[model samples]
Target: MIRVHIARQFDVRAADGRRLNAEELHAEGERLMQSLLDLEQCNDDFCDSVTATDADKGTVLVELLISDETETGAFEKSRTIVRTAIHAIGGATPWEASADLGADYRPRDVQLEYV
Candidate 1:
């Protein structure tokens, strides 16, 4: 099995007198996750899972996990899928995401695990 991880963080401000809640964070995360899931035309089951964690610095961390067979082509396909997904959410230019980039997340630092 091969495991791929992708994470992104964003800082959101309260609109009106209400504060951002877990539900709202989840909705955004889900939307982003779907956009990512659509990549590679892999199966919907390949989505694995997505998580939105609240950060200490008032940031929202979105994590995506996708699993597939162990193969070089699969890895490259996953990389293409991940890169396109992140750029779409952040921006086409790398610098556009400098501010909202996840603290522990690096789009170029993808990890491949074989088991």
Candidate 2:
């Protein structure tokens, strides 16, 4: 099993292009985390479990326990699962993501920019 820790910073904005308040941002972060948990429940073959927490304002920390035979396979699957969870929470965008694959493995810094 490989443990993947992902940190994401979201600059959430409303439809009118205004930044979201602290309360709204917190709610959105909770929603995003719930989405990830739901995805893990559905895709048991790729992931063993998922947990998320609010690191700071506009930032979320997600830890995914992945069950893959190889390190490369785990990395690839983690990327796909994270992306799917983000997309599931429609309208949440313009965020940056980075991943840490334990102590021995070099951290993978993956960022997604949406317009």
lDDT of 2 by residue, 48-107 (tens): 333333334333444566666566676677667766666676543334322321101112
Q: Which candidate wins on TM-score? A: 2
Clashes counted in candidate 2 amount to 0
TM-score against truth, every candidate = 0.41, 0.56
Count the clashes in each prediction. Answer: 0, 0
Candidate lDDT (C-alpha), each: 0.49, 0.50
Per-residue lDDT for 1-115 in model 1, tens only? Answer: 6666544455543333234566655554565576665653655424553535463344445455556665565565555554566566542324343544432123333444443
Residue 59 CA error for candidate 2 (Å)? Answer: 1.5
Overall local distance difference test of candidate 2: 0.50
After superposition, which runs of candidate 1 have C-alpha atoms over 4 Å from their true positions? Answer: 1-28, 40-45, 49-54, 57-71, 93-109
Error of 1 at 58 (Å): 8.5
Tell me the lDDT of model 2 at 17. Answer: 49
